[model samples]
Target: MGHRARSRTRRNCPSLQEQLVHTTFLEELVFWTVKFEFPQKMVCLLLIMLPDTDYKEALTQAFVLHYSRISMMLERSTDPDTLSNRVVHVSVQLFSNESLAFRMAENLNLLHVMVISLKYMMGKILIQNTLHDADKNFHYVVDCGRQVMKEHCYWPLVSDLNNVLSHRPVAVKFMSDDNLLEMWFTFLAMFQGMNVNQREMTQHVEYEPNTYYAAFSAELEASAYPMWALVSHLIDSSSIDLTKRVLTSCLIALQDWLDAINFTHPHMNDSMQVSFHLPLHRYFSVFMCQAIKHQGLSLQEILPPRDVLTLIMMHPLRVQCFHWFPTFILTITITIISSHLISSHRDMERMSGVTWATISLTPLGISDEFMQPGQRMRD
Candidate 1:
């Protein structure tokens, strides 16, 4: 009787083990399917299960997952235009949820990345959406812009402006006031940071003469576009404080460039060589001239045409073989004096001689026409 009972117990134990194995396999399959189907729910569940300190990594992972999913959607969609517009829609919906903001603020670095990604995605969306239906799409863009500024203070949002400026299509027009202000402050912060970093780098170079000026020049040149955009916006908005800051930064940057130029080629120390300087100098000069003009300054007020020409001629690194400064100075000076001659006949004669003297003093030799005293009387 004891042997029979033991045999029966062993047979029932195998059946019980089979049942347990089958139940475990089914449970595993169900869990994976549920995880695949409801990722956000799973994330929320995990967040609830884990301690608060562990939420940062989970939040970052979730943000990255969303970004990946959006990217995949953008790639797979047949209609990029519609998909781009939808990106803003999705961002707006997420932003409206207060809980997301709280979660984002918990991890500032992740928050920065998320905001940058959203701004970039939204900017692209506005551009694409406005391509066909500019009026309607622009209204939507303005709304989004306002929402962004309202939700995220303008100053904090500035951290992402450089990326937006670099990535957005240059041709896209900004119509919203909020967009304009956001851009303005962002640009301000970007240049401000760049200026700080550049100064630090420049200080390092003071002891290292072997450091190539070209390397520093390249770094300065990289910031030109963003600087121009900032200055241009300040000019457009007529923001005096912002404009002053831009001018101050510009002067600092210009002084640095001048130092680099002088360091690289000490021979061309004269101001006249400014015109004959490298292509970058010419580009920067042109931008400066335009910026001055936009600010309503006459050419003479900033610096006489002759002086500008002289600076160009004296620039040591003449990329061009011919010294065009003399001709350029003479032409511009003549035009100015001619325009002035009509307004004030008496002042013209005296002004022409003074201008001629200025040009001659510049690194360039004066033309025979200007040198001949009697000739100046008629022309």
Candidate 2:
């Protein structure tokens, strides 16, 4: 149904609380009036029970709209607890439906909102040497970490965003906007710095290893791998200038991530195994080659410089080079086509007095222009 018709259907349905009251059989079971103080709880229940109907679609739209609005408000929130709750609501809506996840990213604003939320939560948890009492701060740190993780939103936020960004056209639109693109790199920088602090904290903690910290730290890497991998899909489909820009940013981000992370950290290695299985190494290498071929960029003029290339190829998180035979063949094919076009252009320029004409007749049969042609015209 059209959005207007669907919105009208939603308005005609009972109020959210009434739908909950009717669906839950509260009228038959409760003798006294019962009010739901937490409307999100009721909305969650309604989402679960509502069958296939326009009402469900409307509710889904309402939830997505709510998520969009709240996400924008996250930056202004002062209460961490309130911010966490609002972030959790966004996470719930994102996980509830794939279409909702898509709608959240449709306008490309949610991506930046998510970055702000993640950075805020990470900043809270990464607070180190701020308090004099080590004992009190440890508990506080754990609580901050737990707040963002309450609904599996911590990892799923990055992972699901990667899933939603699987749409190339949407991704390109996102990457095209300078503000949104800057936000993406800013996220990478924030993630890198937060991870460095996390690793240091892991190394310095005096108490026994807390599984909660371990799980949270592990999920951090799980989130990181997907966020890094998210851009690989866009490289092949973008315009040459954009592809160059994206590849450059991606390399710089990867370099920053690799430089900051301690691979030997106990939790980090396995988390890498869990999330770093993406063939981004392969994607970047291949697309870099393709970009070079299309732009006729010499190795000396290639993006990221030769030294960075060496770093990427040698590092633990190095780009895995594969499909050599096909890539080789494709490069050769492109070279031949480029040569042929150059030679054809020269030949076209050498032809003197070459002109193109179309079949023509005027009001007077066979016009003077057509009759006077001895100008090497071809019709």
Candidate 3:
């Protein structure tokens, strides 16, 4: 009976070992299958997210799916404050799709107002960059900054503007000019009645070091057209000596700004680099044309009709260099001729009354002969 029991135990052990080996083989196969499938899944996800086909609905669906998973994770977190802060961060991360992020942010009151203010501030900046009205843009940015201060007691708004002034000295120079004087006055008025540095203005996050600096850098580097226009004006209006001094300083500042914007270390990819030379040249050309028109004592002497024609002829070679060159040449020619014709009443009246008839109607006209292909062949 004992021998029979031992034999039965041995038989059971062999069957158990065989079953374990089969389970281990199945586990290895599952692992390999998952590993092979994940990259393909990611590729499909990227293809679905591609913007070329206007798959906004699909993108929104994907965003919803991602946010649902995030919501579940947030629910599982132990600390409520950590979850609140994370919600704020998630809301901000969603800002790439601003409309959706804003919808999410609207429901979350647990986060500090500072984060909301930053979102609004970023939106204002985006609008200002695209908007046509400078005054309106300024008002919007300043108002958002003021609101941030009022709601969150963040004086970094002032600091942000100050840092922008320092880095883009042109903004300050232009802001001091007559055109922007009213806006500056308005800004001063808004801040005057309140405490400049009221720490307890509202209970909010403490000031982060370099907050203003980072903000200014991001704003300036993102768009430097305002700064460029301001510097160009200074260069145009100043006296010769003053112009040279200002230009030298402006160029140095501009170079620094350009480097800051466009600098790409080896770690950065090609798309990360910025190139502003095309825009700079276009603006500078316009500035030069305006300056010449206003300051030149004798337009006829400076650019005669023949000179204008020559300039127009040279244009074809440099077509890629300037878009407005032909238009400007035409305007300059017309201006010079008008100035000449206006000086003499007799010449003006003689040229004005009779429109010249096209010579194509005449038998000897070359244009008519060229139009008649048979005649051209005979000739």
Candidate 4:
């Protein structure tokens, strides 16, 4: 009776289907082994869950998955633009574990694959950021209602990628079909990260109390966009496309900010920070210097026409910017002083110093109350 029961159990079990699927998977693995000539250890590590497997497989699997993912994402991103959040999660998960991420970054092949994936995801997120809700009629979900951007779009992926590059600078992947697309995508991604926005990022805010945060985002982008320092070290380009794009985006964003801040119809509330646009000329100086010193491109090629610069300088926005700085500081001095980084080869050091300076000056930037009578902030 026990033997009959055992026989019945064996017959009823779904081993036949499971074996067929398993066998097919193994056969495909063998085909990959033969076609790609992938290392046995690497293939085994990727295809199976083994005890104490080497991380190289994780890196390999990430690249393999990324290639397929990119193809899928590109196809779906047409017309209707179906950029799945799943791709974002999958891309980030590859680097979720700290140990594997660093290790994966160490390998050039893995790092290249990782960067390409991030470039797409970053660009995708940015499109949503720029065009949201009924504003542009996009199908993708807004990152979050409160923030101008979602954390996943910038943090850890872009931030950690920058970190990894700082430790070990890698080559640009050149994976995009054209160089212009490559530059624009990378620049936009890196731009999103130039300013660190939130606290702990993982925790969501119910709503940003001040709507200025949104305007401030564009304002901050305009201010910082001039220090397009990453362009020289990161891209392999002689084209004016990147420089043109940078100047154009910065100017347009600057205009948007100017319009937002200057217009009285909207009316700012009392809760808004008082000295938000103070020292705006300092960023304007940094942009000119950094662009001229890009090393890869000529000043004439990268910068707007002299007449254009003169026009911008004379604009109502630029004239109003002078009121923010000390009386001793003039518009020409703001544009003439230039960035120290323009002369030095150490882009990283310059950025670090600038970041530190920004941090140190934050408290000074805050105001408990407006100046008494005509007291100047530079005092």
**TM per model?**
0.28, 0.42, 0.19, 0.35
Over the stretch 252-363, how does candidate 4's per-residue lDDT look in tens digits? 4434433333422212222222222222333344444445554355433444544334333432222232244324322333443235334454644643443333222122
For 1-379, candidate 3 gives per-residue lDDT tens digits of 5346434433443221223232343234323322333234443444444454344433333333233233323323344344434334323333335344333223321111222223334343222211122242232222223323223222232222232333323333433333132222222222211111111212443443333333333333322333344344443333333323332333333233223233211112111111112222222233333434443323223222342233322212122122212232222223323534334666455423321111112312123323432221000
C-alpha lDDT of all candidate models, in order: 0.33, 0.38, 0.30, 0.36
Comparing candidate 1 with candidate 3, which one achieves the higher lDDT?
A: 1
Each candidate's number of clashing pairs is 16, 0, 0, 0
Poorest 10 consecutive residues by lDDT, candidate 4: 264-273
Candidate 3 displacement at residue 349 in angstroms: 28
Q: On a 0 to 1 TM-score scale, where does candidate 3 land against the true structure?
A: 0.19
**Which of 1 and 4 is the better model by lDDT?**
4
Q: Give me the displacement of residue 333 in model 2, in angstroms.
A: 28
Q: Which of the predicted structures, 1 or 2, would earn the higher TM-score when compared with the native? A: 2
After superposition on all C-alphas, the RMSD of every candidate to the true structure, in Å, is 24.1, 22.8, 29.9, 17.1
lDDT order of candidates, top first: 2, 4, 1, 3
